[model samples]
Target: MNARLLILLPASLITAPALAQGGDSPLDPLFTCRDIADDGARLACLDAAVDALRSETESGEVVAVDREQIEAAEEATYGLTIPQFRLPGLSLPGGGEDAELAELESASASPQRVIVRDTNGQIESIEGLAVAEISENRSGDTIVRLANGQVWRQTDDTYVQLTRSRADTDYTATISNGALGSHFMRLDNGGRRFRVERVE
Candidate 1:
């Protein structure tokens, strides 16, 4: 929200596509508001940028997502291992119970075993079918595209066992957190495991 960031918004938007492939983009709103000598002018510039983005979102030129959408994306991409989606309702590793999440129903060591039902709680295991597209990346990793329109990319460099897939066959992906914030993904019954990340 700083003035410097606001001034760079225009140029940053022009190069957004470059950021999609893991490249960095400076799309912060502060680009436009920066470099204004007067505090009032800088504030006005920031407000204008916010209003313009809001208008664009309303007009369908751009998408504006809320917390729920973010939660859904994390769920769809990485399973229930998201730390923020479910607040601190978990028991400490050594013992004593901490403050439970306001809406958390239960927390389990196995992410899939965990259950959260509050307004913001993580949903049950993400299970789906209809594997529409199954391809390998340049690194020889499987790229799965579900019929429901979710695209996942294999982050590890492991060759998939099956080269062909049937549309009617059911496929499931399990994602869990490793040490630190690292996330791992598994496909099918777990023959090939990869550090998968969501592409769409």
Candidate 2:
């Protein structure tokens, strides 16, 4: 953005001069573009004068009169208060989805663990369990290991044992739990041996 263009846009938009009442020029109207060398030169001079006036108007030395405030003050002086014109509520036509999402994410609480029952009628104890490592296998199966040397794999509603040994030594094994909630042991049984269940 050009600096001159920015100044020009604001200057042109301002219908009434801030300091001068009724948009009156400080210089007399008689001393216009016609008084210059030629039409083009005269126009240029007029533009320069306008720019100078705008600059002067912007300076803090001049006290700019706000017409609205002036009128309100006058009304109060006369003991007749006029209701000021108010702009209606401004709203974006379309909803701000991104902004709303950002606000929701900011205000949202972090993930929390609630005590839930397991498939084997056992209360899945997550007490003092700080998640150490979480991984997903090639079969889209999620495995969770806690800080308390407890390893759990997503079996069904319950997290079943991926391995019996939880001595902090990582060992991969094949374990099975049926849809009937039956626990079985299968070593090197491949993927088909274990009956997979939804781990909601």
lDDT (10s digit) by residue, model 2, range 25-76: 4554327765877878888888887777667556522233343323322211
How much lDDT does each candidate structure score? 0.45, 0.35
Candidate 1 residue lDDT tens string, 1-200: 43221111122232212112223222355575777789999999888878877775455444333343334334333432323222133222221123322212221212333323335343433433345567777877678765545466777666655524534235555545545545455556546666766665
In model 1, the Cα lDDT at residue 128 comes to: 31
Q: Which candidate leads in lDDT?
A: 1
CA shift of 93, model 2, Å: 42
> Model 1, poorest ten-residue lDDT window?
5-14
Question: Please, what is the TM-score per model?
Answer: 0.37, 0.22
